[model samples]
Each structure stands twice: as C-alpha cells, then as structure tokens.
Target: MESEINKSPKASAFTLIVAFVCVALVGLALVPLLPVKLNPSRTLPGFTVRFSMPGTSARVVEMTATSKLEAMLARVKGIRGIYSTSGNGWGSISVNLDKHVDAAVARFEASTIIRQTWPELPDGVSYPYIQMQSPGQGSQSPFMTFTINAPATPVLIQRYAEEHIKTRLAQLSGIYKINLSGATPMEWRLEYDSEQLRTLGISTDDIREAVRLHYQKEFMGTYDVEQGASDRQWIRLALVPESESRDFDAGRIQVKMKDGRMIGLNELVKVSRVEEQPQSYYRINGLNSVYLSVVAEETANQLALSKEVKAYMDGIRSQLPAGYEIHTGYDATEFIREELNRIYLRTGVTVAILLLFVLLITFSPEYLFLIVVSLSVNIAIAVIFYYAFGLEMQLYSLAGITVSLNLVIDNTIVMSDHYLRCGNRKVFMSVLAATLTTIGALVIIFFLDEKIRLNLQDFAAVVIINLGVSLLVALFFVPSLIDKIGLERRKRISPSKPKLKL
Candidate 1:
C-alpha cells in the first residue's frame, strides 16, 4: 500500500490539495453569512400580559382586570404557574410555561383567550397586550439610544421622531421595539374663570356642551330635491357646514345662561393650544430633549443591526433642520464588537505561538508547513459545519475553535512523526482510534440537563468537527504530501550518513 501511494504521489497530492482548497474557499464564503450573536438561541419559558385602566385604584384593577385575566389564561396548555401584579391604573399577568411546552403555541393560545375574555373586562379596562419573554428579557437593555435636540417644542420633536425616525426604524428588519421619552403631546387647554362664569350664569358643563357642539357634525337626514323633469335626488344635510367644521373658532360658540340669554363662550372661558406635561424627562447637556430607545429582536445579529441603524441615523442627520441635532447616548454593540475582537486577537496570538513553538522543536520547515496546512483545512471544515448546523459565531464557539487549534497541532505532530518512521497504514488506524475516543467523550454532553446542554453544545460541536477533519487530513493528506515532496526519504537518508561514517 505504501509503495502504491508513493508511486502516484504527485497525482494523489494534487487531488487532495485541490479538494482541501475548494473546501477552504467554500468555508470562507459562508463565514460572513453565519449569524453573529452573544450566545446560542434558546426560547424563553414564559410571557407577560399587561392591561391598564386609567384613574382606577389598584384594588379595583385587580378585581376587574388582573383576576379575570389570570383565570382565563390558566386554561392555556402547559401553564406551570400564573403570577400577577396590580398597581395604580394598571395590572400585569405572567404565565410561566413548562420546559417542554412550545412557546409559539402557548403565545397563540394566550392571545386567543385574551380576545375571548375582552368583553368580560371592565368598561374602562384596556385590551390586554401580550409580549413573549425573549431570552435575557429580564435584564435586556436598549441596544441604542438617541437624544433629539431642537429649538422647537418637545411636541414637535416627538412628532418628527415618530413620523420620520421611528417609522423608518420600525420598518427595518430585526427591530423589536422603539420607545420615545420626554414626549409631550399637543393639547387644547380650556381655562374658566369661576367669578366670570357665575356672573354670566354659565356653568362649566354649559361651556363643555358649547365646545362639543362647535366640533360635532350631525347628519340631519336628507332633503329630497327635484332634478330634471320628475327625477328626484336626496341631498345629505349636516348640522355643521363643511366650511365651518374645517376651522375651529371659539368665539363662534355660544353658551345658554341660567336666565335664558346666549353668551359667547370666549367671554367665560379661554381656549389655547398648549403642550401636555411629559410623562418622562430626558436631558442632554442640561437641555431638555426627546430621546428614542431602540430594542433589537431576539435572534438579531446585534453588531450588524447596529451598523444599519447608525447608517440610517447618518442619513437622518443630513436632512435635519439647522437647529436640530441627533446625539447618541449609548451604543451597546460597541461592547459586543470589542469583545469579539478581543477573542479574535487571542486566537491569532495562540496560532502564532504554536507555530513558533513547532518551528523551534522540530527545526523542520517541512513539518511546520504540514502543521499549518492541517490547521487551516480543519478550520475550514469546521466553519462549513457551523453554517450547516446553524451554529453562531459567539464566545463559546470561538473558544472551542481556539482550543481545537492545539488539538490539530497535536494530531499533525503525531502523524508526521510516525509517517517519517514507519510510513504504513498503522499510522492512520492508530490516529483514527484516538480521535474517535475523544469524540465519544464529548458526545455525552448532549444528554445533560437542557440549560447546560444548550450552553455547551456549540463548543462541543466545534471541537468535534475540528478533531474529525484533522484526523482525515493527518492520515491522507499529510502522508501523501510528505511522499510527494520526498521529505520522509530525505530525513531518513540524512540520519543514516552519520551511522555510515562511524
């Protein structure tokens, strides 16, 4: 077998090298397509449903909205426990699902149940809103926050952010939610003077009725109009003309007094457009501002998503008015990017040190070259598997690849040493057996508890793939290439010269 392999060394070496090169090229092509995440994808085991009733006390909210929702949601399959909290004007119900339950199915059932029970809730209670508990939901922060500063009012800034920035960001894929803070809505304030109202014999209710009538449009039936000949048509009639309804004039509204006298509404009440007090406050550089918080989807690639968002913000900045500015308050992706870069730097340093050590010990550039080729081919094969198995390029998996580099070096050393000495099929069999044993040990990880298994699965997979590919490279490609280049023969002959001279 050794003689036959040596006879066609050029052919064998060329074929194997081309095959490995193709594999490397394909793997490099797929590297960019694999998702980059901080951790593996895992479904969270629960979800929350929130409802609100403005101006209602906590006790009333519990009795009316919280209790009813908990009872109705309890019927959902695979529910492990139902927890609830009721506060002033609001309540929330948390449904914890069993580990084996499908989260999607549970969410669908819960939504359907909430809609069915909507009519049973109190009159003022809001429709129950449901949100799935994504991974890290408890401690997840917004990936990006931006403060908008403008010379205009808060209401105007809020409107611009909503209509332009928020709308466009929401349309982007992988954006889970966008929240606006320091948002003040435009409101019409009606100030009434108590003494003036008393003197005019007009009450607040009278003013309210007059204002309502001023904006209200009533359909007062239709008028039968005679057209050409005997043909007749019905014309729709409205209490307020279209022209008058388009513009609001408080002076045109008249309120009836206690003495049956009509007075202008402006005489007793002042109507003015004003900004409502903001629910939340945001400040940048000690100046009041409106800010937006952008949350990423559960499975989104944070680094990629952040890049897209920054590009979008750049475009928005160019179009903003002179006095408007967008300032980034926080960028969470920066940390992730730095962390990944650190890992990459560590991997590169490890490879460099290993190569240096190999060159020092062996003093054989040929052997060092073999080790490099083996490492590269194994890594390429592992990358292909990562893409095929839906593994992410994260901390754990990168650590696995880094550790596997040492294993690749070890396997290459053993194979190269044995091939130079024995050069037989036994070299392949022994290395194959050792590699299989290592894989067997790692396979037990899959049977462990779910939480542990999910965390370590990617790491184990990366190591195992590298080990298997390394074995194939060591057994077939390494020995054939050694024969092709006459490295083995040169080493043996060189050592024999000293013995012959003695």
Candidate 2:
C-alpha cells in the first residue's frame, strides 16, 4: 500500500493536480449552498399548553385548567417533567419530555391526550390552545421585531398592523408567528344606566341572560328533515341581523318587564364598539407604540428572512400614514452574523500566531509555505466531506473547523520535522499513527445515544475528516512539494579545535 501510494506523486504528479482541482471546485460550490445557522439545537423535546378562564382566581385557574392539563399530559410516554403556572384568569402548562422521545411523535401523542381531556374541563374554561415548540427553536428569540410609531393613537396603529401588516407579513414563506404587543382586542361594550335600570326594575344579569339567549350568533346545530321521498336535507340555524349593525339582533331580542310587558334592549342599555380593557401597555422611545414581533420558521435562514422583511418594510414605507414610522428592533440575525465574523477573525489570528511559532522553530520559509498549503487543503477537504456527510455549517461545525486547523498545522509540523531528521518513512508512519489515535477517540463519540449524537455528530465529522486529510497530505503532497522545491537538510559543522603545532 505504501509503495502504491508513493508511486502516484512520483510517477504521475498530474493525477494529484487533477484530483485537487476537482475537490477545489466541489468545495467552493458546496460552501455557498451549505445551510448556515447560529448554533446547534439544544432544546429538548417538549410543548406548551395554554388556556384562559376569565374572571377566575389563580387557584380556580389552576384547578380548572393547569392541574387538569398537567395530569392528562403526565400520562404521555417519555414525559420527564411537568411544570404549570396559574395567574389571574390564565393558566399554562409546559411538559418536558425525555430526550429519547421523538419530537413529532410526542406532539401527536400530547395533542391526542389534550383533545380527549378537553370535554372534561369545567364550564367557562377556554378551549386548549396547543403550540408546538420545535425542538430546535424552543429557546430562539424573535428573528426580527418592528415597532410601529405613529403620531396617531395606539389603537389606530394596532388596527393598521392587524388589518394591513400582519396578513401581508404572514404570507412570506419563512414567517410563521407574528405577535402584536399593545394591541387592544376589538369588542362590543354595553353600558347600562343604573337609574334607568332601577326605574325599569331590570338587573344586569337579566340583560346578560337575554343577550346570551337571543342576541349572539352561533350554528346552534344541524337538523335533518325529509325533503323528498327518500332523501333528507340538513338545515343549519344561525342568528341573522335585523338591524343595520351586525353587533347583535336588536329587533328579535325581548326581555320580560316587571309589568309583564316585553321590552327591547334599546331601551335599557347603550351598545357601542370599543377596544377591550388593555392588560398591558408598551412604549418605545417615550412614544406609544405597537410592536410586531416576527419569528421565522425552524429551518428557515434567519438572515435571509430579516433581509426580506426589511425590503418589504421599505416597499410599504410610502403607504404608511403621515407621522408614522416603523422602527426596527433587536435583529437577531445581525447579531448572529456579527458573532460568526468575530469567530472568523479570531481563527485567523490564531492561525497566524501558530504559523509564526512554527516558522521560528523550523527556520525555513519553505517548510512554512508547505505547512500553510497543507492546512488550507486539509480544511477545504474537510468542508467537502462535511457536505458529503449532510451536515450543516452551523456554529458548532465552524468551531470544529477552527479546532481542526490547529491539529492539521501540528501534524504538518511533525511530518516536516521528522522528514528532515529521519526521512519519508518515519514521517508517514508517525503521522498515520497519530491520525488513527485521534479518529479512534472521535469514533467512540458516534456510539453515544441519539440525544448526545445530534449535538456532536457534525462536530466530530468535521474534525475526523480534517485529520484524515492532513495525514494524507503529510504522506504524499508535502513530500512531493518539498522535493520539487529542492529544499534539503543542511549539514551542521562541529566547532573545529584549534590546531596547535607542538
């Protein structure tokens, strides 16, 4: 095998050049297409369940929603822990699953149990809202956030976002969730006059019961009636408006008066459309603002999504109302990009310092040049294999590359030093043994369970590939290149003793 490997660089150097060219082309092409992310996903498999019980105390919320939901979800397979929070009129439960659980399967199982448990909930409890927090995105911040600052009222800004901005941005491919802060919910407000109510002998409960019975809209149920000889027709019942406004059926609604006469709702109460009581307020730079928080899909490119959002904002700038401006805030993509740039800068500085030290010890520019070339080719090959192995270019993989660079430089120096002292055979054998030892340790990491493997596999792949490539370069390419450059070991002359004529 050694003889066969030796003949390639000597007998046919062009073959090596051709091979290098092919790899270089493939490496450059794959780099751009490689999926880049900030970091590896560390979030365990889990999901969140939320519900609201309006006008209920925290203890009531816990009993009605949080505790029941937690009990139901605790039966799911691979559940690790159950956490619940109950606040005034709101309850939430978070179920953390064991790492061995498949995320998709866990979601399905959890949903099934939650749906089965829904009917058992107490009256006035809201339908459970299930949000699937992806294993990869559980800890992610919003990819981009935009604050709508307008000279108009917060209500107007919120209306603009809800009616105009939310739907448009949701249509973008990468955007999944858009949260609006400081936007009041649209609701119908009914104001009752106490004196008028007392004069009419009517109570608020009586009016509420009347509205609940006759004024609201619903698909009460479907009725099947015989339409013809054998066929049946289904009819759906829905409340239709008899008044100009669709708020309620004011005409059909009648409440029994104390005198036994039928009275209409128009006489006892005033109805108007208004914003619901706000639970929270938001302000940006001392001005009332409506904030639109945009989150990208799990596998989506954050930087690309951010750019698209910015472009969309630019296109709609002119359409915004006068004195209104969209201020960008907390762009996470830009932050990740900066972090990556810093990592790159640090890697370059590290390489330069290492090379300087190697140059001082070797005292040969030729050796330095060979080491640099070997380092470059070793990394390029590692990148090529990284794509081949179907790993992404995330922060973890980049970190692996940085570490591999140091290892490659170290191996190259070892080979060069040995070659100068003892010849090519010693260089090949020593480097091969070192590379095997390192790869053996990394291979052991692959045997770990799925939970551990997901985080480490890409990193291990990168280092192993780099070390393998370094070994090959040390054995073949470096030897051929140094010989071609006519670099040889210089002879050292011992100090000559003074010749004294006795």
- Among the numbered candidates, top TM-score falls to 2
Candidate 1 per-residue lDDT, tens place, 1-502, comes to 5455334344566788778778888998887767666655654478888876767999999888899899999999987788999999789998878777888899889878876787577665655667686443422458799999987777778888888899888978888888887865444455656667778787654665566456652221111111324342211122222221244466898899999989886666556654543546666666568989998765577788889999999999999878889999898778778877887899889888989998898787877787787778778877888888877667788788888888888888888777776555456666777888988999999888666786788889989988988887886777766766646564674434335554
Q: What is the clash count of model 2?
A: 0
* Residue 121, model 2, lDDT: 73
Candidate 1's error at 458, in angstroms?
2.5
lDDT of 2: 0.70
Cα-based lDDT for every prediction: 0.73, 0.70
- State in Å the error of residue 227, model 2: 41
What TM-score should be assigned to candidate 1?
0.68
True-vs-predicted CA distance for residue 30, candidate 1, Å: 1.8
TM-score of 2: 0.70
Question: Tens digit of lDDT per residue, candidate 2, span 90-182?
Answer: 888888787778878987787678667865877556556565655556245576888898766788888788778887888888776888877
